[model samples]
Target chain A: MAVPEVLLQSGVSSLLNSINSVIQSLGVSVLLPIIIFLIALAFRVDVLKAARSSILIGIGFIGINLVIGLFSENISPLAQQMVEVTGITLPAVDVGWPAAAAIAFGIAELGVWMIPLFVAMNLVLFAIGFTYTLNVDIWNYWHFAFIGGLVYMSTNNWLYSVAVGLTLGLFVLVAADWTQPAVEETFDTPGISIPHGTSAPYAVAAIPIHWAVDKTPLGNIEADPDAIQDRFGILGEPIFVGLAIGLVIGIAAYSNALFVAESWYAILTAGISFAAVMHILPMMVGILMEGLTPLSESIRNFMTSRFEDRDMAIGLDSAILIGHESVIASSLLIVPIAIVMSIILPGNDVLWGIDLATFPFFFALMVPIMNGNIVKMVVTGTILLIPLHYISSAVAPLLTQAAGSAGFDLAGRGLITSPVADAGSPATGVLALIPAPVALAVGLVIVLGIWVALRMWPQRMYMVAGASEEKARETVERRHTGKGGGLLPNKLGSSADVTAAEGRSDD
Target chain B: MTTKNILVVCGTSVATSTVVKEALKEKLPERGLDIGTIAKAKATEAPGKVSSGNFDLIVTTTQLNQDKFDIPVIHTTAFMTGIGQDEVLDDIAAALED
Candidate 1:
C-alpha cells in the first residue's frame, strides 16, 4: 500500500526529515558505531567493553572509509580523465558503490522501510529455524534497497519492490546458512559468516562453475599465488604484477596526455598507485577486523550462552574477509582485466567509472571459492564480470531514473551507471533483467531450493568452510616446518571426519 | 655488530602480518634479540624480496619457497590462531642468536 500523500505531508515527512538530518549531520561513521554500541548494550554486554567495541568499530569504519576515499581520490579522477582523453563515452557514468548507496538510502519509498522490514523478517526466520545468521551489517541494507528500487521501477508497483526486497533478504539469509560451513572452515573463523550483499550471490554463481572447473583436468592443476610464484617467480608478486598492470592502464588512461613528461608522470604514478593500493588496502582491512573482534567475541559469548546446542554465525560485511592474500591478489589482478574487459567487450556501454573501490568487495567470496587459487580466480572473475557490463548497461537507464526520483540532481549527466548495481551484482541483474513476476517466481524456486538444500545437506552447503579448517592446519604446519615449495596439496583427508566436525552448525 | 633484518610475510602482508609483527615487537626484546629493520611482504613476494640476500630471518604465516631464502624461515599461524606460538618465538630467538 502506498503511504497516502497527506500522511507524507504531515508528521511522517517531518519525522523522516528529522531522522535523515540527524543521519546526515552525524555521518555514517559516527552514526554506525553509536548504533553498534546501543545494540551491544541491548545484548547486555558490559558497558565499558561495549563502549570500547563500538568506538573501535566506528574507528574501523572511519579507517576503511578514509582508505576508500584515498583510493577514489586517486583513481576516480584517473578514470574520468581516461574517458575524457579516450573520448570513450559508454553512455553511463559509473557512480560506484557509495553513490549507489546514497541513491538507495535517499529513496523514501525504500529506505524508510528496509531496516524494520528486514529485521522483522530476520526474527521470523530465526524463530522458525530457517536461518542462523544474525545480519547486523544494517548499513549494507542499501544493497537490498538498490534491488527493490529496480523492481519497483520495472513493475511500477511499490508492493513488488517491497516483496522483492524482502525476498532478497530471505535469500541472503539462506545463502548465509549455506555458506557458513565453508566460511567457518576456510577462514578459521568459527563463529561468523558473511551475508554480504555482493559476496553471497556471487558465491551461489561460483558454486556450479567451481564444480565444473574441478571436473576439468585444470582442476588437477593448483595455481594459487604461491604456486604461481613457484612457476613465474617475480612476475607472480602482487606488487610487480600490479605495477605492470597499472602502467598499462595508466598509459591507456592517459593516452592523450599532451606532453611526453606528463605521460611519463601518469604512467609512473598509476603504476605506483596500483602497487600501493594492493599493499595498503589489506592493512586497512586488518584495522577494520581489529575493531570488529571485540563485538564478535561478545556476541559469540552471548549467543552461545543462550543456545548452547547451536553454533550461531554472526553475519558481517564481506570486507572482513577481503584481508586474505588470494582475495587481494585476485582483485588487484582483475583491476586491469576489468579495464580491458570494458574496452574490448563489444556492445558494452559502461566505462567503469568510479566503482573501482568495489573490486575487492566483488572478489570477497570468489577467492575462497577458487580455494585461494589466484589463476582460477582471475579466470573466473573475468568470465563473471564480462556479463556484468552488459547487465549494468541494460539497467543503467532505470538506475538513473531511480536516482533522479530519490532527489538526486542529475540534470547535466547524460546516463549514470552503477558498476555494482548493474552487472557487478548478480542479484540486481537477476531482478532487473527478468520481468518482476517471473523474477519473483524464480526467486521463490531458488529460496525453496536453498531451504531444502540446507535441510538435507547442511554440511555440504558449507563445504568451502568445511575444507577451510584442514587448509588452515596444513598451512600452519607446512609454513612452520619450512616445506613450502611444491604443487598445491590435494584435499588433505578422505575421511568423513572433517565434515562431521562441520556438524556443529546443525542447530 | 650486525643488525639483523627480519621479513614478516603474510599472504597479503596485511592482517596476519600485523599480528605477527606485533608479537615479534613484544617478544624479541624480551628474548634479548635486537631488531634492526622489520619489514613486511606478501608470501609470494618473499623469494624475489629475499633474493637480494639481505634479510636475516623470514617469519610467515603462509607456505613459502624456503630453499630460495638462505636465511632461517619460521612458519607459524601462532599470531593469528594462537597455536604453537612459543615454539615460534623460541625458534626466532635461536635464529637471532645464531
Candidate 2:
C-alpha cells in the first residue's frame, strides 16, 4: 500500500511539472494576450472585440520579437566589431522603447497586476481629491511596470516592487499638475496635462535649470525655430538618421577590410537594415496600440463617467506637445549632440541607438518650461545628457536581466538598455539604488506631500513657477467656474484666439 | 467610390497617432466615408510623408504648421480625450468630400 501511494504521488508531481513547463514555453507572446483578454472581459468589453484586441496584442508581441531578433542579429555583431576595431568599450545596445515596452509587459508576475493597480490608484486618488488628473493613458502604464520589474529583478521582492511603482505613479501625477499651466500655455491644449513618465519628470528638473539660465547672459539669446527647423530638419528624419549612423559604425568596424567587396556589402546592408528597424519597429508598436485601443477606451470611459462633473485635468501622452516648432528644433539639435556625448562622456558605456529618434519627447515639456527659448532648451538638454549617460550605464545590467526574464533571446548579445524611458529616467535610476523598504518610505512621503500641496494651492504653485498674476488669477477663475477647460463647447469655439495665443506664448 | 487616403500625424507615430488612426477606422465607415490606407508618421516626418503620399485629408492630435501644407489640416485632441469626436469626424468627412 505504501509503495503504491508513493508511486501515485510521484506521478501527480510529474504531471504538475509538465504543466508548468508548458505554460512557460508559451512565453509572453501567447500569455500576454490571454491576460489582456481576461482584463478586457472584466471591464465588460464586447467579447468579440476583446478577443480581437488581445490577439492583436499577441501578434504585436510576435512582431516586436521578430524585429528585435533582426536588430540584434545585425547590430550586435557590428557593435562587437566596432568595439574591437575602434577600441571603444561601449557594448550596451540601446534597443529603444519598443523592446523596452515589450519587456515591461512580458513580466507575467508583475505585468498582470499593473493595470489594475494603477487604475485602482487613480480611482482612489480622484475620489479623495488627492489628484485632479485622471491618467487615462493606459498604454504608457508600461513605464511603471518597467520600474517595478527592475526592482523585482534586483531584490526578488514583489512587495518592494509594488511600492516603488506606485510611488513613481503618484510622483508623475503631481509633476503633471505642477507643469499643467505651462503645458497648456505652451502646447495650447487647454484642460490636458501630460503625466507621461518619460516627459513629466524632466519638467521638474528643468524648472531650476530654466531659472538658473535666466540669471545668465545666455537667457537673452534666442534661436529662431523656423531657421533651425529649416536647416537641421533632415536630422529628425529616422531613415536618414539610421542610415547615417549605420554607415558610420559599419565603416568604422570594417575599416581594416575596406578593400574587400564583402565589407562594403555588409556596410550597405547595415545602413538599410538600421533604417528598416527604425521605420518598422514603430509600425509594429502601432499594431500593439491597435490592440490596446479598445481596452484604453473602456478605461477612459470608466474613469471619465465617474468624474464627469469634477473639475480636473485629463492626463495624456506627451506626443501632443512634440509638434511645437521649438520642440522640433531643439530635438533636432540634440540628436548630434547626444551622439557626440555618448562617445566622449566619461564613465558611460551605453551605445546610443534607436531611442535617438525620441529626443523630441525629452524636450517636449522642457521647451514649454523654457518658454520656447530654443537656445536655453538646447543648452539644458546638452547639460542633462551627461547624467543621462551615466544613469543608463548604471542600469543597463538590470535592464538586460529584465529583458532576459521576459524571454528576449539575448543569448549572445551584450547588455541592452533604452535611453529615453529605461535607464535615462532619474526617478527609476535613483529609486533603484536604495533598499526597497527605505525607498518606499521616502517615496511615499515625497509623493503624499506633493499631492497635498498641489491640491491645496493649485494656482499658487503655478504662480510660484512664474505665471503672471493675471494669468494665475485667470487659471484659478477658470478652475472655479469650471467653464472653458476640459471638453467644453466654449473652448472649442475659440480656436482662432487659441492660434493667436500660440504666437504670443512662444516669445 | 474612390477610397480617400488619410495621413495621421503625432509626436511618436506609435502613440497618439495610433489612437487617432483606430478611432478613424471605426468611425469613418459609419459616416459613409470610403477610407483607404490610413498612414501614420511622426510630426517631424509629416512634410516628407505629405509630399510623397497621395493623402486626401490630414488629421493630427498635435500642432502642425498648417501653413506648410495645402491639405486641410484638422488639428484636434478630441479623439484622444473622447471629446467632440463627432464634430471632428464631421470635419474630416467634409474635408475628404472637398
Candidate 3:
C-alpha cells in the first residue's frame, strides 16, 4: 500500500511539471506577440517593430538551431564522439531537433562551398527589400539572432559551428547597410521595404522568391535568378578550378606515400588521383568518393542535399534534387588531370605556410559569401586570424595531452575523427583519440573563427550590394521618369550589385 | 669533402620540422649526398637553438638575415604547408650544385 501511494505521487508530480513547461513555452510564443501588439497600439511603430523583430529573431534562432541539430547528427564519427563525451552508447538521432538545426545552419551559410553566392544572395535580397520597403528589419533582426543562436547552437550543435560562423559573417555585412532609406525604401521595417511604384501585393511575394524567380526579363533582369543559379551551378567555373586545386593536392599527397601501398591500387594512379580530388564539391565530394576512407555517409548525404538545394533555389531545375550527385562524381575527373603535373616535377616541396594556405582556404571557402570581394574577405580574415591562431595553439597542446599514445591526428583523419569548429566530442570513441585539453582549445578557436568569418564576410557584401542595387533601380526609375539624371550606385555595396555578380569571387 | 649539415629552421621547430627532418634524411641519399640533414631547433625569430657555425646550410620558409651565418641558405614555401615542398627541395638541391 505504501509503495503504490509513493509511486502514484511521483507520477502525478512529473505530469504536472511537464504540463507547466509546455504551458510556459506556449505563453511565450502566443501571449508575447499579443502583448507587443498592445504596446505598439499605444506606442510608436518602431518600438512595435523592435518587439516583432526580437520575436522573429528568437524564432529564427530556434528554427536555425533545430535544423543544425538535425544535420550535425548525420556526421557519423561526430555522433560517435558525442557518445564518447557523455560516455553513452546510443547512436545520434536524425529526424529530430539536433539534425534539423545543423542542416539549417549549414544551409543558411551557403558560403563554405561558395562564399560569393552567399554574399550575392544576401546583398540582392537586402537591396530589393530596402529599396521596396519590405520587412527590412528582418535582415538586422536575423543577423543578431544568428549571433545569439550561434552562441546557443555552438555549445550544443558543435559540428555546425563552422557554418554558423560563415552565416554570422554574412549577416554582419548585410547589417552594415541599414542607415536610412534608399530612393526605394519608403518603409523602414525589414521585409516591408516598399519600393517606388510597387504596391503591397508585389512586395509580399517578391521578398522570399527574390532569387527563386521563374521567368524574369532583361530590363527587369535583377530578378533574373535563373542567370544567378547558372553562375554557380555544377557547370560553373569555380567548381572546375576547385577540382584542379584538389587534384594537385591529391597527387602531391599520393607521391608523398599517402596511399596505403604502391603494391595495391596503381593501375591509373594519375586518373585515379584526379577522380578522387574532383573539386566539384569541396569538403564533401573527395571525402565521400573515397572507398575505404572512414567519412560517414549520412553527413555526406546532407552536404549533397545542401548543394542540390542551393542549385535549386538559385534557379537550377527545381525538380531535380538528387540529380547533381552524378555531376559531383563526374566532375572529379579534373582533380586527376592537374595532379599529373606533380609526377613530372616530384622534387619540389609544395607546402605553403599554414597561416598563408589555410587563411586563404578559409577565405576561399568564404569568398562566395563575400561576393568576390577579396579585399572584403581579407579584412574579415585578418580580424579573425589572431584569435584563431591562439585557439589553434591552445588546442594543439591540449590535444597532445589527450592523445596519450594514439598518435595525435592532424587534419584529414577521415571525416568522423575530426570535429566541426573543432567541437570536443563526448569523451569516447573517435574524438577520444583527441585528448580533452587539446580538443577544448581547438574547439573554442575553430568555432569562434568560423562564426566570426561567416558573419563578417556576408554582412559586408550584403551592405555593399544593397546600396548598389538601390542606386541601379533609381537610375532605371530616373531614365523612365524623363529626367535622365545620374543615379546608379556606381560602386560596391549597391542594391542591384548583389545580382550583378553572384559567384565571381577571385580570392 | 668536408662534413656538413643542413638545418631546416621553422617557427616551432617541433612536429613539422621533425617530419621534414625525417623525410629529408630518407630522400637525401637519392640526391647523392651522404651528409646528415637536421631540423634546426629554432624559429625565424629564435633561430639560435642550434649554433650558428654548427650548420653548413640553412633552409627555411622565410629568409634569415644571414649576418649571423656564413653557410649557404635556401628558403622556399614548404615548411608550413604541403604546397611547394617538392619545388623547395629542388631549390635546395640546386643550391648544393649537386
Candidate 4:
C-alpha cells in the first residue's frame, strides 16, 4: 500500500540542505575521519594495533590501486599485462587470470559465491577423497581467501570487504598463535609469527600465479586444528570453485545485464561491482610469483601486527562475525527489501536513483540460505522479486500510462510509484551513501548475534587463553630468570592478566 | 606538564578522519592523556610534522611508507576504525616517562 500523501513525508529538506552546507564547510578537512583514524592509530588510539595495521594495509592497497587506476581503467588488464611481462600464467583451464582476480574480488566483496561453491567443493573433494581413497586429501588450502569470499562476497560491498579482510587477517594471525599446539606437539617454535612488512600476503596478492603458490607449499606452517579447521571450514575449496563458476555465470549474465539495454543504473552497478572484484583478486599472476623467501619475517610481522591489540582484535572479531550473520539474515530479508525497492524504482526511474545494488546482491546471498530451507528462501526471494516488477509496472505507466483501472495515482491514496523526491538525495559520492542508516542497523543485528556466538567456544579455549598467558608469563618469568624478561616487568603479566586483558573490550 | 599530544592525519583529512579524531579527543582524556591538536595531518607532512618536537606519539590508520621514524608511529587499519584508540593513548602515556 502506498503511503497516504497526507501522512507520507520526505526527509526534512533543511536537513539535506544543512548536510550539503556541512560538507562544503568541512572543506577538504572532511578527509580527516580516516586520516585522523590512521594518525590516531599511529599516535593516539591505544588499541587494536593489528587492526590498525590491517586498515593501513587495505587503505594502502587501495591507494596503490588508485594510482594504478590513474594509468588504467580496468585493473584486470593491467594485472594481466604484468603476467605477460613475467612470462607465466595460471594453469587452471576453465578459470584464468582475469576471472580469478575477479572471482577473488567478488568473493571478498559479495559473500554470496561461497554458498553454492561451499556445497559443490565439499562434495567434490570428499567424493574424490572417498573415491581415490587418498591420504593427502584433495582439500583445505584456502585459509583466508575462501572465508573472505564466503563472508565478504555475495553482498560485494566495500565496508564489509575491508571489515572482513582486517578481521580475517587479524583473526588468522591471532588464532594461529592461540590455536597453535603446545610444546608437546611436534612443531613447537611456539610462535608461527608471519613476520612483518607484507600486508595480508594472501588477500592483497596482485598476481594470479602467486595467489595459489603462496598457499600450496605452506612456508609458515603451524601446528593446530581449530583455526586451521575453522579457516578451511568457512572458506574451503567450495568457495573458490563457487566463485569460479559464479564469475563465468555472473560475467555472462553481467554481459547480458550490460545489454539489457535498460537504464544506466543496472549497467553502472554491475560494472562497478565487477571492476572492484577484479582489482582485489587478480588471477594467475599472483600464483606465478609464488615462493618462500625472507618474506616470512614480514609475513610474521604483519600477522603479529594484525593481532597487536588483544581487546580491539576480539571486538573486531565480534564485528566481523556480526557482519557475517547480518549478511546471512539480511540476506533472508532480500526478497522483502527488493519488493519494496522495485515499487520505488520504476515510478521514480527517470527522476532519482537509490543504491539499489544492495538488493540484487542480497538476493545472491540467499544462495546459501537457499540450500538450507530452499522453499523459505525462495519464497522470500520471490516476494522480493515481485515488488521490482510491481513498482516497475506501476511506475512505468504513471510516467507514460493512464491512471484508470490501477488507481495507482488516486487522490485519496498516498504517493504511488512516482513520489515527488528521492529520500536519499544529495547523496553524491560513495562516501555520502555510506553509514547508510539502513545498512548499519542490519550490521548491528549481526553484531548482537556474534556476541551471542562468542559464548559458544569450548572451555578449552579458556584453557588455551590461560595457557597463552602462562606461556607469556614464562617468557616474562624466564626474562626475570635471566635478562630482558624482567626488563619490562611493569608491562608483562601472567595468564590471569592475559585473560583479563582478553575479556576487556577497552584495549 | 608535557601535553600528551597526538596528530591524527590522513589523505585529504575529510569526514572519516574527523569522526576518528573527535572520538579520540572525547575518549583520550579519561586515559590520562592531555589530548591536543586533533587537526588534519597532511600525508606529505605527516611524519615530519608528527615526529617533530611537539606530540608524544602518532596514531594513524593510513599507511606511511617511511623506513624509520623518530617517534613511535602506530598505523591503524582502515577496516577497523576507532579500533586502536585506547591502546594508542596508553602507549603515548607510557612514552611520556622517557
Candidate 5:
C-alpha cells in the first residue's frame, strides 16, 4: 500500500511540473489569453465568443512581436548611423505607441490587476457621488499599466506599482469629469467625457497657459484652421512624414557615399522601409484593438449596468475629439515643431518617431480651451513639448528595460522611449520622481481631496474651467435627477419617471 | 451581388475605428450585404479619402465634418459601448441597400 501511494504522489507531482514548464515556455502570449478567457467567462460572455476573442488576442500579440522585430531590424541601425553622421547624440529612439502598448500589455503581473482595481475605484467613486463619469475606455487602461510597470521596474515592489497605477487612474477620472464641458462645446458631442491618460492630464498644463495667453495679444490671433488644414494637411499623413524623415536621415547618414549608386539605393530603400513601418505598425495595433473590442464592450456593459439610474457621462477615448479642424491643423503644425524641438532642445536626448501622429491627441483637449485659436494652440503645444521631451529622455532607460522584459528583441537597440506613452504629461514625470511609499501616500491624499472637492461643489468645479454656467448647472442637475442628457433624442425614455409617465398614458 | 465599399473614420484610426470596422465585417454579411473593400482613415483624412476612393458609405465612431463628403455618413458609438448596436447595423444595411 505504501509503495502504491508513493507512486501516485510522484505521478501527480510530475504532471504539475510539466504544466508549469509549458506555461513558462509560452510566456505572455499564451498566458495572457488564458487569463483573458477566464476573465471573459467570469464576465458571462458566451463560451464560443470568449474562446475566439482570447485566441485573437494571442494572435494580436504575435503580430505585434513580428512588427516590432521588423521595426527594430530596419530602423535601429539607421538610427545609430543617423546619430553618428549628424552628431545628434540622441541615443534614445521614439518607438511610438504601438510598441509602448505592446510592452504595457506584456507586463502580465501589473496588467492583470489594473482592470479590476480601476473598475472597483470607479464604482466606489460613483457610489459616493464623487464622480459622474463611467470610464469604459478600457483600451486606454494600458496607460495605467505602462506607468505601473515603470514604477515596478524602478522600485521592484508590486504594491508600489499598483498604488501608482491606481492613483493615475483616479487622476484621469477627475480630469475627465472636469473636461466634459470643453469636449461637449468644442466637438458638439454631448454627454461624453474623455478619460484617456494621454489626453486628459494635458488639460492641467493648458488651463494656465490659456489664462496667460488671454492676458496677451496672442489669444486674439485666430489662425484660419481650414487654410492651415489645406496647406499643411500632407504633414498629417504618416506615409509622407515617414518618407521625408527616412530620406533626410539617409542623406545625412550616407553623406560620405553620396556619389555612389549604392548610397542612393540604400537611401531610397530606407525611405520606403520607414514609410512601411509608419503604415504597418498601426495596422498591427488595429488587430490588437479588434481582439480587445469585445472584451472592452463586455466590461463596459458590466459596469454601466450597475449604475443604470445615475446621470453618468460616458467616458470614451480621446480619439473621439480628433475630428475638430483646430485639432487637426494645430497637430499638423506641431509635427515639425516637435521634430525640430527634439533636435535642438538642451538636455534632451530622445528622438521622435512614429508617435508624431499622436500630436492630434495632445492638442485635441487644448484646442477647445484655447477657444479654437490655432495660433494659441500651437504656442501652448510648443511650450508643453519642452518638458515632454525632457521627461521622455529621462525615462528612456526604464522604458527600455521594461520593453526588453516584455520579449521585445532589444539586442543592439539602445534605449527606447515613446513621446505619447512615456511622457504624455508632466504629471507622470513628477510622480515618477517621488519614492514609491511617498507617492502612494501623497497620491492617495491628492486624489481623495479632489474627489471630495468635486462632490462638495459639483457645479462650481464644473464651471471652474472652460464650461459655461448654464452647462455646468445642467450637468449638475442631470446627475442629481437622473433624467436628462440622453445620447439619442428618442432614448429620452431612459429615466424611470419618464418611463412611468409613458406607461400611465398607455394604460 | 453588388459589393459595397465602406470607409471607417475615427480619431487615431487605430483605436475606436477598428472596433467599428470589425463590427461591420461581422454584421454586414449577416444582413445580406456584400462588402467589397473596407478601408480605415483618420478624421482629418476623411474628406480627401471620400473624394479619392469610391466608397458607398462612411461609418464613424467619432465626430466628422460630414458636410465635406457627398457620401452617406452614419455616426454612432454603438460598437464601442455595445448599446443600440443592432439599430446602427440596421441603419448601415439600409444605407447600403439604397
Candidate 6:
C-alpha cells in the first residue's frame, strides 16, 4: 500500500488550504463555535447538547462584542477629548485587547493546534491533580499564543515560543486555583474560577500588597462601595460617580470648547455619556451572560459529576466576575487614577484611549484581594497602574514589531501600538520577560509559598471564615425557601439555592 | 384600579435592574395588576428617590434597609442568577396585591 510522496504532499497542502479558506470566510465568531461543537463531539457529549452549547457560546461572544463595541464607541471619544484638552501627547496608542488577540490568532505557526494542545495539557494536569480548573475560555487562548508568538519572533525559534506560551498558560491555571477561595469569598458565589489573561496574575501581587495595607491604620477603615453607597447616597452610586468623573474628564477635555459660545454644553454632554455607559455596559454584560451561563452550567455539571470526590470549577472569562457593584465602583475610581498616573508617572508614553473601558475588567480580581473595600481597592489599583504604564511603555517597540509582523501598518499612522495596552501590562513587566523555564520555576515557588502562607494564616489573605460561607448560603436558601422574606415562590426553589447548598455541603 | 408605580433597584442599577424590570413587566401583568410606570435606580438612589417620589413598591436584588424606606422593600437575588425566579415574581405579586 505504497502511496507516492508527491501526491501525499499535494493532498496535505490542499487540506491545509481548505481549512485556511474556511477560517478566512467565517472568522472567529463562526469558526470558534464550530470548533467547540467538533470538540464536544470528540468528548462524546450528546449531539443536541453539544450543538446547543456551541450556539450559545457563539451568541455569548456576539453579545459580548456588541457590548464592547458600544462601550468603545462611547468611551473612546471622551478619552481622545481629554488628551486634546490636556495637550498630553504620548508616543504610543494602545490598540487594546481586541487587536492584540487578533495578532496572536493570526500567527501561522500556532494556528489550529493551539486549542487542541492546550486542552490536552489541561486534561493531563487535571488527571495528575495539578489543577482544579478546567479552562473553558478557549477564545482567550490568544493570550498564551501572544506570548508564544512574541518569544518566537524575538528568538527566531518556534521551540522557545511554544515553551513560553505553555508555561504561561500553566501558570495562569495555578493562579486561578490560588485565587479561587478568595473569589468565592469576595463575590459570595461558588463553582467557578476566573483565569483571565491580565487580571489573574495581578491577584498574586495584590494579595501580598493588600496584606501589607491591612496592617496599616487604614485597615480599620472599611470604605467599600456598598458602605460608601450607604453613607454618601447618590454620589456613591456608579452612575452618579461615573457622571461626576465624566464631568471632570469632559471639562478637562473640552476646556477650550467650553469657553467658546456654542460648546458650553459639551462638558455636561460628556457627563451624560459616561453616565449612560454606566447603565448600558452592565446590561450588555447581562445579555452576554444569558448566553454564557448555559454553556458554563453544562460544563460545570459534567465536571462535577465526573470528578465526584473532588471540587471542580469551570474557568471562565473575567467578564463573568466583573458584574459585582464594588468591582465596577472600584474600577470607576481607578479610571481617573490611571489617567492621572499615565501623565504624572515618569517614563510613560502610552496614551489612554479605548483601553480605559477595560478598567472594570482589570480590577475584577483586585477587588477580591481588597475584600471589596473600594478605598483599599482604589489605592492598590492606583499603585499597580504606576508600574503598568511604565511596562506598557517599555514593551512598545516589541509590540510595534509584532504588529508589523502580523500585518498592522504603523508606518503611516505616526503611532506605535502596544498589545500590552490593557491585559499584557503585568505580563510584560513581570513574568513574561523572564526566560521560560526560570519564569515557570519562580512562579511555582511563589505560588507554593503563598499557598502555604494561606493555609497557615487564612484570615490574613481574606479567606472567608468557615461559618460565614455556611451562613451566607443558609441566608440565601432561607430567603428562597420562604423562611425569611420568601421572595421566591415556595414550589420552584431556585437553581442558585441548589448550587449554593451543594457548594456549602461539599465544603 | 389605581395606577401603581414600582421602583426596581440593584447594585449598579443597570444590569440586574434591566433584567428585573423585564421580569416584573411580564409577571406584574400576569398577576392582573394595573401598572403605571416601572422605574429603576441604584440601591443608593432608593432612599432619596423613594422618599421624594410616591412609590407603591420597591423591588431590589440587594438587601435594603427597609426602615429607611416608607414603602415595602422586596429583596431577591433572583435577578442576577435567574434562579428562584418564580418565587421572586410571586413575592412581587404578593407585595403589589398588599
lDDT of 5 at A474: 70
Name the best candidate (by TM-score): 2
Q: Estimate each model's TM-score.
A: 0.61, 0.91, 0.25, 0.24, 0.89, 0.62
Model 4 per-residue lDDT tens digits across residues A443-484:
435333332222223122323322343454553332223322
What clash pairs does model 5 have? none
Q: Give lDDT tens digits, candidate 6, residues A186-261.
A: 6655655666676776666666667777788777776556554355556655567557756776677777777685
After aligning candidate 6 to the native by TM-score, how far in Å is the CA of A503 from where it should be?
A: 34
DockQ of each: 0.17, 0.80, 0.01, 0.02, 0.69, 0.17
Q: Which regions of candidate 5 deviate over 4 angstroms?
A: A1-24, A480-507
Interface RMSD of each: 6.5, 1.0, 22.4, 19.3, 1.5, 6.4
- Scored against the true structure, residue A321 in model 4 reaches a CA lDDT of 15
Best by lDDT: 2
Q: Is the docking of candidate 4 incorrect, acceptable, medium or high quality?
A: incorrect
Q: Is 4 or 5 the stronger prediction by lDDT?
A: 5
lDDT against the true structure, per candidate, is: 0.65, 0.82, 0.31, 0.31, 0.79, 0.61
- Per-residue accuracy of model 1 over A1-507 as CA lDDT, tens digit each: 356777667778799889878776675456655766676676577788777766765565455455445545655566566668786646665656655665565455565357557766765565555676677555556678888887777777888898888878888888876666566555655556677777788768776767777777766666555443345556655566557656765776778764689778877987887667555555554554444444444543443344344435566556556546676566656767777788788888886544554565677666556677776666776778866888888888888787766555554445667785434577877766798888888887998887765444333444543345555344333222332222322123333333456555543
The positional error of residue A170 in candidate 2, measured at the CA in angstroms, is: 0.8
The sequence of per-residue lDDT tens digits that candidate 5 reaches over residues A1-507 is: 899899999999999999867766777788878888888788778888888888887888888788777767877787789778878777888888888888887887777558767888887877766666888888888888888988988998888898898888888888887778767876776777888888876766677877787788887776798888878665658788888877876787788779999989988987888888888888888887877777777888889998787677788988877887888888888888888888899888877778887887787778667777889888888888888998888888888888876767777678888886655466678566567788777767766676665555656556655676677667656553443333322112233332244455644
Candidate 3 global lDDT: 0.31
A1-507 per-residue lDDT for model 2 (tens digits): 899999999999999999779778999889889999999998888999999999999899888888999999998899899989988778888989888888888888786578879999988877765666899999889888988888999999998888788788888887886777777776788889888888876666677777887799999998799887978665669888888888888998899899999999999999998899998899888888899999999999988899787777889999988989998888888888888898898778888789888888788888656778899998888878887888888888988999888888876689998987757877766677667888788777877676555544545556544455466557655653334333322222222232244445644
Candidate 3 lDDT, A1-507, residue by residue in tens? 899999999999999999767545553324333433443333234454445433542343344333322233323233344335443332211111111122222222221122222334444543432211112111112222222233333243434433343333332322222211221231112211211111111111122233232223311322222333234344333323433443333343344354566512432333333333222112221111121011111222222333331211111100011111211222222223222321232231111111111111132122122333333333333333333333333333332222211111212222211111221111111112234345445544633453343233433333332334544344333322332112322132333332445645532
Off by over 4 Å in 2: A1-19, A455-457, A463-468, A478-507
Worst 10 residues of 4 chain A by lDDT: A130-139
Task: State the fnat of model 4.
Answer: 0.01
Q: How far in Å is the alpha carbon of B67 misplaced in model 2?
A: 0.6
Model 2 interface RMSD over true interface Cα atoms: 1.0
